[model samples]
Target: MSDYLSNPLELFSVAGKVAVVTGASGAFGEVAAEVLAAAGAKLVLAAGKKAELAAIAEKCRARGAEVAEVNVRPTSEAVCDELVRTAVATFGRVDILVVASGKNDVAKIVDMAPERFLDVMDANVTQSWLVARAFTKQLLAQGGGGKIVLMSSARGLLGHPAGYTAYCASKSAVDGITKALGCELGTQGITVNAIAPTVFRSPLTAWMFEENDNATAVRKGFLGRVPVGRLGEPQDLAGPLLFLASAASDFYTGHVLYADGGYTAG
Candidate 1:
């Protein structure tokens, strides 16, 4: 993992490469992009809000990355196409794609509004597919293969007591896409993978952790038993992120690496 000259394999260093990350405005995403930038990547950050993305880009630029912007609207074609095009125009090549766009709503299936379910699915799963399609084409043109990471959830792997039907189904779709994409792109030197996390301490997850009488009350005993004895941290995910983004994972495709601190062990 050393980028030091003393270690020859350090060529795996992401220096000078370009990485395109979706959902760049969010906490987990900003952290991930910072990690990549520190390790030497020219970042192309895409998020919904222009001002938020401008801030993320400013930080990455300070770290020496060339930046670009894309809104996550109309995922079917426009945004994804624009994302790939923007990166290529700015950095001249695409080396990594991190599909971190997501949406979630906890409601019983019976009560989940049709619009809400569709919105979550489009954001979580459909956007990923659209972006992958764009990234793959550019990766093929670059001709050395590419690394793709999809953001999924532990909810996709297990049943939850809460009404997470829509969220769970969307995440499960991410897993399936990773598998199908791995097969379809493997022959072209593209590796596709998914990361399923459990309750990471990010803006997306902080709401649930805020002590609510009814919620935290029901989970008082369970909190004491998390095997890791601590909530998931952004730093805790860096190692695996690096692995999947570098040549170290060249042979790994269609795999979902769980970083849930034993949430699925039992």
Candidate 2:
């Protein structure tokens, strides 16, 4: 047996692999890129903001990872195709893909506008599908097994009393995509999975933990439902991202790994 099979730690090594991370400018994407880079993977980072993508590329480079930055709307199929081509041209191949780009619009069903709901769906669901499809094409062409990690949310699996009509619907769609793709792609040596997280401390969710009466009440209410009694941190997702990106999760597909603090379990 190879050292990787004998030494389990070796299975988690993503050294020398090339990873393409979408939503690289977002809070979760930034952390995911850092974790992959820290594991010795070369990175192709994509986001709608050029400046933010550039900044993230710099950080990854500082970690000794060869990095490329792509500024493109991941929702565009043409743009997503270009992203895959760019990764291949820069790093020779794409071994892993992380679709961390998403959007959430909080509005009650009665108050939500149809356009806004569709926009949320386009951003969270359609964009992810386009990006994943683009990369999967490259992986199939290259004839090697690959890894795809989609970002789902705890909201995808469970509904909330709060205004979450658009957000919840979009993410639920993402969960379906993950499972369907995982089943369809398994035969090609590709594994598709998702990470579903509960309320985490990201820039997008910072308000909930801020110092204020409402924030305090929100925190208390959220924590009451969580068995772990604590919100998630960016670093908390690093290990999970690495595991799904590496060979450690070779046999796992069509799986939604919840990183929630027992919120889903409860």
Candidate 3:
């Protein structure tokens, strides 16, 4: 056997790598951390809730990966800077960063309060930008390339049928940010990408399933419209996240990958 072929296991591996995931206490963030751990990454779990972050860190530890936790609003530039410091201090380097903290509130543009609109924008877009900037800076300073993953949604691509003016605006802003930054930083070897998921079971989507009538209608609507006849799970984020974290997507940047159940096709 050739020496190169003998090391085939090196590809698709994250051994000795460190990843920082924001919103690690949330369903999606927790799954992302666990999956990365399974793939051989030390994890730095960032979230606003202290208790929940600790819990998830323990879970990642149980999976045979090192883990640390940081509490931050995620939207604040100062907080994002601190998160990078925390990750570097924990593992000595940050190989990947996932900006996954987000919120969805119903606020029609005509009737929405200014503060509410600002809240959605700050949480969904501004925070992602802050995190991305801080991590990219760290990577440059460390003299190594890095991967950045932004959490966007299908709503960012299409208009909402109901009242989602603020949420939609925030997500669309994220798509723009991802593309713009990816172009600016591509030459620096920092690949930026966004994941657009369909209706997934999370706190952001809980309202759609509330009340039997609303829930049934939403389910049926998705079933009829989407080619894939099922809702997405937290694990749905695993593979794409890994690809972005690894060398597989080295030539890719500024792309919006739809992890939807073909919801965007029609």
The top-ranked prediction according to lDDT is: 2
The residue-by-residue lDDT of candidate 1 on 171-264, one tens digit each, is 9999999999999899888899988887777865675566797657544555564687556888877877778888778889999888888877
Q: What is the lDDT of candidate 2?
A: 0.92
Q: Can you give the lDDT of residue 113 in candidate 3?
A: 88
The candidates, ranked best first by TM-score, are 2, 3, 1
Candidate 3's residue-wise lDDT over 15-43, tens digit each? 78889899888877887889998888988
Model 1, residue 35: what's the lDDT? 78
How many backbone clashes does every candidate have? 0, 0, 1
Using all chains and alpha carbons, the TM-scores for the candidates as numbered come to: 0.90, 0.97, 0.92
CA lDDT, every prediction? 0.81, 0.92, 0.85
What's the true lDDT of residue 195 in model 2? Answer: 93
Clashing pairs in 3: 75-127
Which segments of model 2 are wrong by more than 4 Å? Answer: 1-5
